[model samples]
Target: MKIDKDRFNNFIHSYTKDELFYRSLYNAEREHPETFSQYVDTLDRNFIEQHQLYVPSLHDSWFPYISENEFFQTYSQNIYIAKHNRYSPEYLHKHEFYEFFYVYSGTCINTIQGKKQTCRAGDLCIIPPETKHSIAVFDDSVIINVMIKSSTFHGTFFELFTNNNALSHFFSHTLYEKTENNYLLFHTQSDTVIRSLIEDIYIEYYGHKKYSDSLLDSYLMTFWVILLRHHENHLESFLNTTHQNLALPDILNYFQANFMDITLSSAAEHFGFSVPHFSKLVKDHTGKTFVQIIRNIRLEKACRALKTTNLSISSICEIIGYLNPEHFNRIFKETFHMTPSEYRKKHTNL
Candidate 1:
C-alpha cells in the first residue's frame, strides 16, 4: 500500500467527479440562463451522486445542518480527512463535529456567522462544533478538511492545547465551551515544515496501511505541537467573522493560571485596562462575568478531581478555591445536582 510521492501528487491534482460536474453546472448556469432550468430538469441521472445534488430554494440554495452520526459511520474511526470539493459554493450550515480547514493552495471565501474572510494559501481555520459557516471556491483552489468527532475531541484532544500560554488558552476555552461563533486562524504559508507534514498526513490517510491509524494520530500530534511551538506569532482568534480578539487569549490564560487568587481589579491592572473596560471586555468576549469564569474554572478542576482522584471532598474544595465545606457542597450540588461524594461515586462506577 505504499504510494509514491509523484503518484499521490497526481491524484490530488486531478479533479474529482463531483468537482467536474459542479464546474460544468456552474458554467452552464452562467452562460445559458434561459435553458438552465430545462437543462437541470433533464440532467443525466448518473452524472452526479444522488445524495450530492444541490437544490435551489425560493431565495437561495442551502445546505442543511449536518449531524455527526449522519456523516461518520459507527464503525469508522473518530477522525476523518478529505479534500474539499472544488468549485462548490457551500451555503451556511452547521455540523455537530469539529473541522480543521487548511487552505492548501489558491484562495477561498470562508463565511463564518455571516462574515466573510478570504482564506489564502496555508491559512488554517479551526471551526468548532455548532458553528455556522460556509466555504466557497469558485476557481481553482484546494482545501483540506480534517474532521474530528465531537466526543473524541472532548475525550482525547482537549488537553493537547491547555498549556499556560495565550494560544493554548484560546484553544482551551474554544474547545471546552464549544462556543458558537469562535474560530482560530493560523498563517503558516511560509512554513515549509507544516506544508510537508500536511502532505505526509494526506498520504498516510489515503494510503491506508495497517498502522496508518496510529501513525495518523502521531502526525496530528506533531502537527499541533509544531503550530503551538513555532507558529504562535502567526495565530489569530475571531469571535465572529469581523470581530477579532487579539488579547483575549492571554487574558484568559492569566485568569486560568490565577483562578484561585486573582481578582477583577488585579486582573485589570495586570492587563493595563481600566476596571470597567476590563470587565466589559471579559463579559463581551467570554459571555461570562469574572466571578462566573473563576467559578467555572474551579468547578471544572473539582469535577476532574472527583472523577479521577481519591481526595476527600473537603480537600478537593480547598484545592479548587473553596474555603467553607458547606459552601462547596452547596455549590457543587447546585451545579451537578448531587453532592461531591455522590458525583464521585457515580462517575467511579461508570
Candidate 2:
C-alpha cells in the first residue's frame, strides 16, 4: 500500500490525543470482529500507526526557541535543534523515536532525567524514546538534533537490526545510557571526523540528490551501527580490564529499588566498588556517569507522575525522592524549563 502523506500528517498530529485513535481502532475491530487482528494490521499498514503514539512535549512549560514541525522538517528525519538562554530542567524528551544531540558550541550542564553533567563542544548524546531528560546550558549552546522512528526499520533489515541478539540486547538495555546529568561531557578529540559524518548526513538529506532517500537511510543505519559498536567496544574493554560483571538486570533492579534514594555513592556501594571506580564503570559501560543514571530514573518517575497522577508539585517531588523543592525546581526547569506546576497545568487532561 502506498504511504498516504496526508494520513501520516494527521496521525502525527493526533498522537497528542492517542486515545481517540485507539478508540476508533477498537470500534473498527468490534465492527469487524472476525478480522480484529487484520484491523490492527490495517492501522499499521495504512497509517503506520504502530509508531504514531506521541512523545510528550519536551518543553511544554517553556518558550521553544524552535518550532517542533520546523525542526522535524530540517532533518527530514524528525529532528530539530534550539539554543536556550538558561538551564532547562531536562535535556530531551522522546517518544518512540531515537534522538541524537551533538553539542556544537557553548558550555552546559545537561541533566538527562536527573543526573547532571556538563557538556561542551563536540559532545554527542543519544536519547532513546520514552525517556525523560533536561539540560541547563551554562552558555548559549547550539545542539544538532536527530530523531529516528523505530518503525522506520523495515523488511529483512528490520529483523537484522531489531532481532539480532546482540543489537537487541543493547537496545533493550543500554541504548539510552546517560553521559552526565549536568554536563558529564565527552570530549571529541577527533572533532573533524564526527563533524564530517554529521555534515555528510545533513547534506544528503537536504541536497535531495537522486536516490537520496535510500542514501540517507544507508547513512543513518551505518551511523547507528557505528555508534552502537563504539559503546559495545567500550563496554567490552571495561569488563575485560575491571573484571566486573555488570549485568543489565542487576543495573535495572538496582534502579527500581533505589531510584528514590539514588545517589552516586549509593550506586557505587550497590555494585561493591569505590565511587571513582563505579563512576568509571558506568562511563565505560554506558558512556554515562552514576549521577546521570540516577537522574534518568528520577525523570522517568517524574514523567509517569506527570502523566498519571494528580499529585501536587511538592508531593510529586517528594514521591520522586527529591526533598528539596528548590533543587527539584531547578532540576525540573533544567530538564523541561517549565515549573512542575506549569507543566502539570498544561499537560493535565481535563
Candidate 3:
C-alpha cells in the first residue's frame, strides 16, 4: 500500500479534537496562573465531559488498568497508532499491551515505573505490558504513540531477534521471563533511516489498504533491526546491568527451528555451555525448565498450524516433535481445554 507524502504529512500535523481543547486550556492557565484553578473549575462544571482526559484524582492512590479492548476496539488488527494530545497532564496508568512513544519533534516527559525522564526528538521509548507509565506532552510537541497487542510480541515480532546479543536477551527475558518493570529507550540522533521508517509506519497505518498489516509488520521489523544494528550504543534498557549472560535468544530460536529433534544436551553444546549451566540459564531467564520450553514451543507451533493450515492432526503432531498422536491430543487438551480437532473447528468458525 502506498500513501501520498503530502497527505500523510497533513494527517500527522493536524490537531485532533482533544488536542485543541487541551491547547486552549493550557493557554488559559499560562495567561492567568492566579485564577487558573477557578477557570479550570468553571470549565469542569460546564464542559468537563468534553475535555477532561481523566479525573484528576484517578492517579492519586491507584493507577487505572488500561485494557486492550478499551483502545483497540473491533476494527484493530493487533496495532493502534495515535498522536499524544498536546498539553495533556500526567495521568498515570498501566496497560496490558506494548506501547512505543516516538518523539517526532520537541520533547515530552515520560514517567516509567515512577521515574520521570524527558525524551527529545529521535528518542523511541518502548514500554512493555503491565508497566506503570504515563506520557505528558505539555508543549507543542509531536509524540507518536504506537500500541501493539502483547500476543503479537509473543507470537510474531519477537521472532526476528534470533542472535545472541543484548537486544535478543532483553526481549527474551521481558517477554517470557519473570522479570517486571522493563522498558527500552533508543536514541537515534539524526538517523535518516529511523525517521523514515517511523514515517512509513505511520503512513501505512493511516492509509491502510490491502495487505497493509503485513507491510506494517515488515516495516516494524526493519525499523527494529536497524536500531539493533546501528543504535546499540545509544540503547538504554531496564536490565542493562543485570542478566548479561542470559543470552537465550539464539537458544530460543534454535528450539523453535529444530523442535522436532533438538535435545537439551545438544543445544547446550552448540552454545558452548555445559549441560548444567545451560539448564540453569534457561530456568533463570525463562522461569521454565529446558524440557518445558521445548514443549511450549512445540505446542505453540501446533496451535499455529491448527489455525492457519489444513494439515491433519497426526501430521501436525509429527511436525511439532510429537511421535504419538495420542500424546499430542492429550497435551493439547490439557493446555487448551479442548482436543486438537475441536480447537481447529472452533477457529475455523471464527
TM-score of each: 0.65, 0.38, 0.74
lDDT of 3: 0.77
Residues 83-117, model 2: lDDT tens digits:
23232233354344455666756656655555566
Candidate 3, 1-350: lDDT as tens digits? 35576566566667877787778777777798788777666654345454446435232543478787665654446688778888766677888888888988888988887899999999998888777888888777799988987655655666787766666777777766766678999998778888778888888897756556667777888988998888988988885234665456767777777778999899999999999998888888777898987787788678767766789999999998899999889988997688999877765412
- Residue 259: error of model 2 in Å? 39
Candidate-wise lDDT, in order: 0.75, 0.52, 0.77
Considering every candidate listed, which one attains the maximal TM-score?
Answer: 3
Ranking according to TM-score, highest score first: 3, 1, 2
lDDT of 1 by residue, 1-350 (tens): 45576566567657877888778778878899988888777766654446355635222545468788777754255578888888765678888888899888888999987899899998999888778888998887888888887555544444455556645655556644426788888999868788778888888877766656557767888898887788788878875332354455567667767877789999999999999999987877666788887887788778667765788888988888888989989988997688989877765422
Off by over 4 Å in 3: 1-3, 28-52, 57-63, 67-75, 240-244, 260-281, 289-350
Choose the strongest candidate by lDDT.
Answer: 3
Going through the candidates in the order shown, the clash numbers are 0, 38, 0
The candidate 1 region of ten consecutive residues with least summed lDDT is 55-64
TM-score of candidate 1 to 2 decimals: 0.65
C-alpha positional error of residue 204 in candidate 2 after TM-score superposition, expressed in Å? 2.4
